[model samples]
Target: MKMKKLKYLSCCFAFGSLLLSPVFAQNPPESQADPQAQSSSSENSHPHGKAYRHKMAREMHEKMQRLMDKQDEELKKLANEMNKAPKDQKLDKVVTLLNTLVNQRIQMHEEMKAMHHKMMGNHKEHHE
Candidate 1:
């Protein structure tokens, strides 16, 4: 009976230690995570002021709209110039207008991309 009781206690002790092993284990190294992923996680854990973010987004939209409207006006001016050109020069004028329009469009696209990048960077910073 004594031997049986001692064996039972030792078995219980082993099982209890097994159950609690995780509680004593070292935490996984944070360096294992991608730096950007860790940074984004930390940023997400902290929230920006809702009103401030909204206001910034609204301003950005307004600025983009203004830029688009200016582009439209420039395109219309190009169209007028092409229309007014002499018949002999019409093809050349059209080519010039098209090139100008393409360049303007490319510039606009680059500006918009830059704006988007800036906004996202600001948003991440503000979140923290």
Candidate 2:
């Protein structure tokens, strides 16, 4: 039981890391020789400014919310199954559900990463 709990905790930590890694992976700003030029270029780079970025962020948040809702439904179903499972099979059922949740999180992370990449690509193309 303790071993199972440890494994579950580790899986949760790994899932959290996967969810956060992309946010931390963003490229750092490069130093510019001219601050004025840098400021002007940055403004030009994002013509639409904060509003556009906020809109994109809002859309992404909606997408993530939908995905999470679906995951919640799946988890509820899994929990129901676990409750119905026999004592002898409960451990196996838990492990299976945990794997399912982990896989779902991984898929969510990948989708988010892809969406972020596409958004960045579009932003770059717009500037170019």
Candidate 3:
């Protein structure tokens, strides 16, 4: 009976995967268009657009740097706190701090990526 149920589940999973494959395989229509044309048109849409892009990039870069610096300071503080804790209590605190650091790192990475996308003009349509 268990073997029969397992086989049925496997068949269902296979069928589900097959049904979803095409949706995953197809690219979005936007990506199919000429990227150069889109970028050029977008850049030309505003007077002084090139300078504007440069200014935006600079601001985002500065913001990213600030975020990274703050995270680093927090991590260092956490490390110091971990060091000061009693040995028996240290393990639990370490785990908590580690999780916090990991989350902050992920957030920093995402922000950096968004900044890069914006700087590249790829995010203007969605961001603006």
Best TM-score among the predictions, by candidate number: 2
Q: How many residue pairs clash in model 1?
A: 0
lDDT of 2 by residue, 22-120 (tens): 533645456523334544556556758557756887898898889889987997898689769986676666766778777986787798779869767
Cα misplacement distance, residue 86 of candidate 2 (Å):
1.5
Tens-digit lDDT track of model 1 for 1-100: 6775566556445544543455215443687334345455545455654556568779888987898789779768877886798765655666666666
lDDT of 2 at 10: 77
lDDT of each: 0.65, 0.70, 0.64
The sequence of per-residue lDDT tens digits that candidate 3 reaches over residues 19-45 is 345422535378535645566565676
Query: What are the TM-scores, per candidate, against the unseen true structure?
Result: 0.58, 0.60, 0.54
What RMSD does each model have against the real structure?
A: 30.9, 6.5, 12.7
**Where in model 3 is the C-alpha error above 4 Å?**
1-47, 120-128
Best by lDDT: 2
Higher-TM-score candidate of 1 and 2: 2
Q: How far does residue 121 in candidate 1 sit from its true spot (Å)?
A: 0.8
Model 1 lDDT on a 0 to 1 scale: 0.65
